[model samples]
Target: MPYNTSYVPNYIKRQARMVLLLLVLFTGCTEVIELDIQEVEDGLVIYGRISNSNSANEVIISRTRGPETAPTPISGATVRVIDNNGLVRIFLEKEPGVYTMQPSDSPGDFGNSYRLEADVSGRIYRTDFQELMPIIAQDELRYEIGVERDITSSGANIENDVVRIFGDSKLPSDLPEDFFIRWEIEEVYSTLTAFLPVFWFPGAGGRGQCYIQNKLGADQIYLLDGRNIRRSDLNNRPIITRKIDNSFQNKHYFNLIQSSISEENHDYWEKVRTLTITNGSIFDPIVGKLQGNIKSSDPEEEVFGFFEVIGIDTTRLLMTNNDIPVFFVDPCLFLGDKVFPLLTVPFGCVQCLLDEKLIEPGCLSCSAITNSTSRPSYF
Candidate 1:
């Protein structure tokens, strides 16, 4: 045996082969888990154009890509553009989901970063950076709200509370007169899976009939005491405010509880509502009344409302980092040496994007402007 160590026995060799075969059979199998991406875009397609002074520049955002549709037609979307600083530079709603805007000043420039955001079904999405030489500023807008009449289903009459947008800017007389305008109202209830879409009256002459869609007929819209627009009409001159000393105080449902744990200083985030109503486009048949138990009125339970462009939040991403930087959607400002990536942080609850990573938004340094005085001195 010592002289023929290399010459192993056939029986020993057979055992070695069997051991190797057994190991391969037991440990050499594996499988991969793949991700399932749902095809989206069945919702309304709201896309639009933004006209700027700096030549023509297109706004594209992947996050804002609407859900999946059968035969998706890209046309007719109401497009809105956010400037380098996170401001709603351009916002116009088309028939479906198309928004269009002209350069309030000039076309977007290169090197400047801009973010594109959209609101659909009460959920909002923002796009990645569209680097341009410079992002132009769309004429700023001043928004207000008004109150009008809201008829009921079974015959209960109620007043309607409406949002009025009074922007001070130059109106183009060349562009065809206000032919028609359509807007989409997105409503989401905690108990429902589908968001309620309320498409309302066609407006002309920069005004028309529009109301909250999908109301339970009985829900009456409320008009806050003093909300009206400037007009020459006798009855509609100043939006008439009908006071309701009854249980349904429109201000009752305005107190929205906000957690101070993480927040930003934005005028829009301020809990109080400071909107004035316009005369021409007053609320006629508004839906959904401010309904709540007035017993021991708590500001937390009041049903708050929307005012205008408060801020832009980015889509949540699953990445190595947790704190996503917040950036102003200003297209004019380019990345300086001190600036990090043009940031947009996501809001609301989000599951892990991709896999094995987490992305969430951080508190911003800007302060939210509160309209405490705007709400009537009455509680």
Candidate 2:
């Protein structure tokens, strides 16, 4: 019997987010139109990542679905990782189509080559060996406030304040001049619930202080090459930016993770970003299948996605309302006495001073409005 890994819906959800972001950025100012996308038989979609940490490595396998359908997990597959040292570690499925490295397995080492192999329904699939690259540390993370203009759906121009984050790093002279890098960002912040109820109902949880963490989807592949630079150190390079909103209400932290990748991996992501940007354009080049390192023993089989071993470095920065000199009103307003008749009370009240009516769902629990409730230790 073949053991399988656990299914993590978030993994694919992130991929979907990446796709959506690319579409939004690439198709700016285009007229709203729909194209008939043809349906085809589902193919294999694999997403895997490996790093130099002790944490468990993961790979997600699912069958591609139609444009209107969600992907379904592929099960009963044997998965293994082999290093150039000839040592092989088998992965067990914790859930359908999700494979994870055993806790006892050793973490990937830098300067070593690793390959992945999967046997699904007697068909063998494998990836070309990828070498682990050296990690590069970020020297600094900086930001700037500016204005951005956009045309609304109704053809009106709207200008909004925006914040852009930038990063810098230095390349040591001893290292090779040719290199590839990838960037990712995550946000952590706290939210306040208006009221806390003293008496708890069976299913009603009191709301007070809640925190949430979200990983922002990066639309563009932030791949950089040392060969393109004349200096030994990379100057201020832009990472990402966002409009000042409720997320920056009290305090927030953004973490930027930088990964050094192989030239092949860099090219793969570059092609993906290009294809996404040029999709549906008359001047667009023929969109051929973007192939990955993964391959199948059967000549007729098709595979999608990449498996990578990367060297990573991270830097975190905190931002507060003070950072943005602009003054904005709180979007989440208090219901006040008007909500008493409707059974919707403010979040801070312990009990209804006047009536026994139930409070609003969101006022009762902060988690109800956000995906996470636990505050991060660093925050």
Candidate 3:
């Protein structure tokens, strides 16, 4: 899985905006005040996951810091996973504080209880045995094209051509009513820049049509409970939506992953999702330190995040250019005879490119825009 830190600040700003909006609506006005907040000692933050897939299992241990400081990864810790049958597998520290299970080890067994144990600085932290829940495969994955108005950073409204992905799944009547379901999505798309005129600079490699593929999906969490569902089968339930842009100008693919999780795991993620959406507002649920299944040997020690074992079902859907409306200007328009000096150029070409900042290097390379130069196996 790819890790992106850029979304963290954007997520925080969006939550802050929601809080301000609610405050003004309820109080009729808003006042800015400064409060001196005492920083607490950093505590342990652990994140780990085990799945039924062949993907490597990983555990990340880090220590929290002040709001203005970034969390530091904790290294030199001993970590292992133990099954109910007494089978033990030690995780190797592949990076600073990242530990991964060996490829020779089992991915994970469904319906079996597993426990995570870690010793950091002579303090043992462990989680109660968590059983992997069984998941029902998604019946279908589909999408529809539509249009919506989006507000820009300057508060200007613009029409956006969007593609919404939906899924269908049938629940077994015999399953427990409290079963929890979560959805994750991954998008695979190819990029082409062959249409652009080839330009060579000193020490620059040849630039031509290179089929590039990229994956996109993270940050968004969708959760549901079987007990709250009224129907046995879900149809046309929206999963995610993306604004159709240059990234979708060619063929695009979506991989939808549905997972069944334990109630404890579901509750932990639900609270986290709520925290991100609510920030800290009077109308929001009272904010508290998030508790996980992991427990420290010392009663006063604090632990954050969780380790989860889940069963997943995945389905893939493909989309072509005809499936979505294109609303983007030609990227090459910015070059304007710069790469092709013999061609007649338009008036105010330099000013237009400078104003739009489209002369930047990315616009000339489709692979540099969003995806990678390497094509995906499926593509």
Candidate 4:
């Protein structure tokens, strides 16, 4: 996935924190109250990750829904990170509750320990100083076509082919045995417009096909526990699987990112993953709040969510339609105008290519699709 400098909401990421928000909403349960746990005054949820990649560091502060209030962003707070060396680096609020550090300032370093401090309304919330570990680069990413069985909504079993990706990683020799690893996968694909409707002249050639780039699966998380493994090299470890679809019909790139995280961070996410599976069943009992490392000065006030410091290494693998064992249908294929219900005319009817099917934006231009880019620089 492209490195984003701006603040993106936790809900938008669809990460583990989004599920934690559900706990904030169900705090009135008798089981949680019996546990002597009181909700944070504002239901504060502060989540952020600062990495060696300066451009991707960001902090998001928002309130979860309470008894009578809807969730909202927390604004006008002072957010900063301080290192063991006494260097205080302030993060500026780019949006309401999103803060990003000035990249030109002191970027994150691997050896140093850092602490996050947020001052809101004279109350201070902070996390214990967490040390950043050395980056662990991915050795390689491998993929193969495999068939998997799926059940339809009507309960009919069917088989579908999918692309399964695996990864290889060689752990650093000097690292402690207690270190943890996390893998994140992202997919970028390209598409082209089948045809262009508007023409300046009778002979005007079809507007050159617009090549659009799209991204997917950036929020999924995969974790690995490195403490027990005696071997240094991890080979052919299963990473992720994606269904073979139209996105594979073009230049598709799978980005595998590896990061070394603290054991505390790993445990927090592990709890989330466990809760997520149990949450699927309505019969399961609601889980109480999963406290994070963030702490507040007032004993009654509790802060939820984690602030993590990590170093990430990424590897990209490019695949095309030729990579798939079976033929994949092209979304842009021109079967017939009737297949596309919407139509429009882009120019004057005289010289304009006035096909009713052209009213569909994708038929006229690939740019009509969301997150579509005309040129892919990585090519």
Candidate 5:
């Protein structure tokens, strides 16, 4: 599941200015608002999600750590999910504030309703019950190579060719009349290093090739409200876009995780998406509140974050360099270039140096790359 780490922490901080900074990035005019330091209190944030897939279920608790900072994870909290029949399944604490449920534990079953409950220092916090809806499987997932304008960090606009993934789904003709949809995109691809070192180096041994996984199109939100979507089928919904970078050089797989969520949860994410994305227009709203379903026992106590129950269905699309028309030259192509003909070894392939930073020389070892793993079975 996709979680908004930055927005959650800032919302818990309760700084009006930061709140505005989130939902509304800019306005026609700016005003300075002062907050009383002594009155500022750290608020609780509980972000939890349970889905049909056990591996995707987890909960995290934390507290605001003041301004310009990340939230601090709270430890030793009791967390669990309770079904309508009063069956309680406990989540074991895997890390500080991270709690997880095993496969043997209670699974989120469709047609059954559930709610989250947490006990922190004798205080109880819970969310309203939500039913696990039927799964909405993706009917077709396809991609196309196209050109679009992109902005550089230097604020320069340039036209660039890229790949865009699109998805289509049709609801079943029977039963449930309404449904809300959310999509999470994950990218997995294989990468080869220039040098396969003899000695074991983290993610590498003798193999120079490795697999990497990361979120795709995380900056954009993909959601559909059943009420707004009049038809039974959703078509050509733009899912994600990617630049013709090194990630596309090999077998690239995009996992489209479809989640059937509650209208309230969809509203929660919609509110967050609006708060986080901006065009810097003068008509933007100055401020908005980011609230979740979780509530504290004491009405006066403040809490932030959400507890979501959803049904998930996943589908993947594979694309390789051959799929794209534009040929992208590798940044590390110098390993094969004859510019340094006399050099017996690929310069800096053995060890990354100051000059090698420009070409991502660390990738020569594969192990040096973040999230690098052994060749995946599918790859």
Candidate 6:
């Protein structure tokens, strides 16, 4: 079975106790899950999500076993919101699987990075991400960008090369933790036939967290889905592009220019780095077409390492990378509405829009918190 019917939590202070239990059940086992559980257990199969002020296309957290789902639509598990500084939150379970924290003094702080914390019994496990600020503008209303790329030998095909978007404006620090990048572009195919703009995403797109970059083994995920054709070895697998040889369509290549938002996280708020990829650049083998709408969006960004400290001031941001583009800088790249929503089980996460307020580097939401009160570096 690919899922489990129940979960159990045991309190064993010694390592020996853990080893013994694992030895009894680990040789080989498989299980799959179905709708609501027939029973409940202390060790809950948690469910939650992350979302933003944008429209309704929400994705959820899922294992490698299948496609993405909306936030598992949860309500009972304990929810913890941890700032990069280690300041932790023990959210109150307001409903069955819904957890709530008192509305903050203002909105979430942008300059500061945050993560999540979940506890079951005495065990505390952490996701690769944290709570974060909303990446948008406050004062100056609106923003836009144009993207185009040259083709390379890589399987990536440089197709639609332009992208644009409108937003209030952006501050060096307003970038959110779940950076959900969106690229609104002209439809590639005919509307009557091609109803939607060919949107590209990482690991798992729209459906859930699968499209999130770094969410899973980027290139390797193709194997899990059985989407590629193999040679002798799995490493030698081949991709299956949409149009082959003579089937290539020129009209299909040019995406109509329209309102759009492509993403490439410009800063190190989350302690990660993106490539020099432009709008039409192809990324990994599994991910083909570099449509005019490039999506650098995902709920959890990879935090390869860290800096001066978590939850610090703008001063903490010193141009850390030398090998980059001048257009690239601290938290400059993101969508007007959201980056990505946190994947909370059955239901994806949700984030509200920026409260048309003034944006100053040091000011996040209305309650600007600084490292004056430091925290742990759990991320």
| Candidate topping TM-score | 5
Give the candidate order by descending TM-score. 5, 2, 4, 3, 6, 1
> Is candidate 5 or 6 superior in lDDT?
5
Best by lDDT: 5
Identify the runs in model 3 with alpha carbons over 4 angstroms from their true place. 1-40, 137-139, 150-157, 193-199, 207-220, 273-288, 327-338, 341-376
In model 5, which regions exceed 4 Å deviation? 1-41, 149-159, 196-204, 273-289, 326-378
Look at candidate 2 and tell me the lDDT of residue 71: 59
What's the lDDT for candidate 1? 0.23
Q: In the order shown, what is each candidate's alpha-carbon RMSD?
A: 32.1, 7.8, 8.2, 8.0, 7.5, 23.5
lDDT of 6 by residue, 1-379 (tens): 0010011111111111110011001112222212121111111232232222111111111111111221123334455655566665455654444444433412235355544455434444344443333322121211122345557798676753222222121323423333222111111211011111113222222211000001111111110111121211222112111212111121122111111111222122111111111122111011111111111123242211111111111101011112112232222122434333212112311111123321222222112311111111210
lDDT of 2 by residue, 11-68 (tens): 2211221231221111122122222322323777676766675442677677756444
Per residue, candidate 1 scores C-alpha lDDT tens digits across 83-142 of 677555664432222233444634443345555555443344444444332111112223
TM-score of 1: 0.20
Q: After aligning candidate 1 to the native by TM-score, how far in Å is the CA of 23 from where it should be?
A: 50
User: What stretches of model 2 exceed 4 Å from their correct place?
Assistant: 1-40, 147-159, 199-211, 215-217, 273-288, 326-377
At residue 304, what lDDT does model 3 achieve? 73
Cα misplacement distance, residue 333 of candidate 5 (Å): 7.2
- What is candidate 3's lDDT per residue for 89-157, written digit by digit as tens? 788887777788876888677888889999999999999998877775345788888988879999999
Q: Show the colliding residue pairs in model 4.
A: 343-359, 344-359
Error of 2 at 40 (Å): 5.2
The residue-level lDDT of candidate 4 at 117 comes to: 94
lDDT of 4: 0.62
| Model 6 TM | 0.24
Q: Say what the RMSD of model 3 is.
A: 8.2
Give the Cα lDDT of each candidate: 0.23, 0.61, 0.60, 0.62, 0.64, 0.23
Estimated TM-score for each candidate:
0.20, 0.73, 0.72, 0.73, 0.74, 0.24
